[model samples]
Target: MKEGAKLIHTSRIPVRWGDMDAYGHVNNTVYFRYFEQARCEWIEQMGFPVSPREAAGPVIINASCTFFVPVNYPATLVIRMHAGEPGRSSVMTWYELFVEGQDKLYAEGAAKIVWMDNATGRSVPLPEAIRALFDAAAG
Candidate 1:
């Protein structure tokens, strides 16, 4: 974890057989899905709607991942989620992926989430509840 990065959630996801490609390893795109699962869990647990059709909600501006080792099926993955300091309307979330029972890092990822008005498709200030969560994590 980076300095000042607060771990907010963790998830264990099983690697599915279909996650593998012809290369016999988990497909590169699947790594992002794993990250998304962990991130979504965190958001939902925070009492935020995963998808809001008419109200302000969160949307990803950008996302990225770095694969250090290829993961295979028959494995349970532990994904640790971290949050950086919040901005007015955005926050940077980080993730580290590891196979269960292993200390090695399989991948690391990040996504910048911005609060947006669903009706107007415009950025809006993050909800106070979210800012309070960051503040609690920081302390």
Candidate 2:
């Protein structure tokens, strides 16, 4: 997490057997899924629809992840999400993944999400309610 980033949401997701690859470790792709789940949970908790086809909704324009340690099965992942300053139409969300009861970080990542008009496929300003939540979190 960055210096000014605000903790927004935390999610506990169990590592599934299918999340592993032939290398016996959680696949790199699965890290993004974990990040997505946490972000979605945060959005849902904010009273926004996850995927609103007829209304403006959040959409990720960019995403990336960094693996610090290999994660194995039979562990519950604690993903904590943090929010940077909100822009007119987007916010940068950061994530940290760790095993439950463990202090070591397994992975970290971020995604830049922009509010978009579903019908027009163009960016729109962040909803006032959402922006207010970000403001409060930053405090």
In model 1, the worst 10-residue window by lDDT is 46-55
Candidate 2 structure quality by residue, lDDT tens digits, 1-139: 6779998899999999999999999999999999999999999898998877648999999999999999999899999999989999999999999999999999999999999999999999999998899777666
**TM-score, predicted candidate 1 vs. hidden true structure:** 0.96
Off by over 4 Å in 1: none
Model 1, range 87-109, lDDT digits (tens) per residue? 99999999999999999999999
- Measured against the true structure, the TM-scores of the candidates, in listed sequence, are 0.96, 0.96
What candidate 2 gets wrong by more than 4 Å, as runs, is none
Clash number for each model: 0, 0
What's the true lDDT of residue 44 in model 1?
Answer: 87
Q: By summed lDDT, which 10 consecutive residues of candidate 2 come out lowest?
A: 46-55
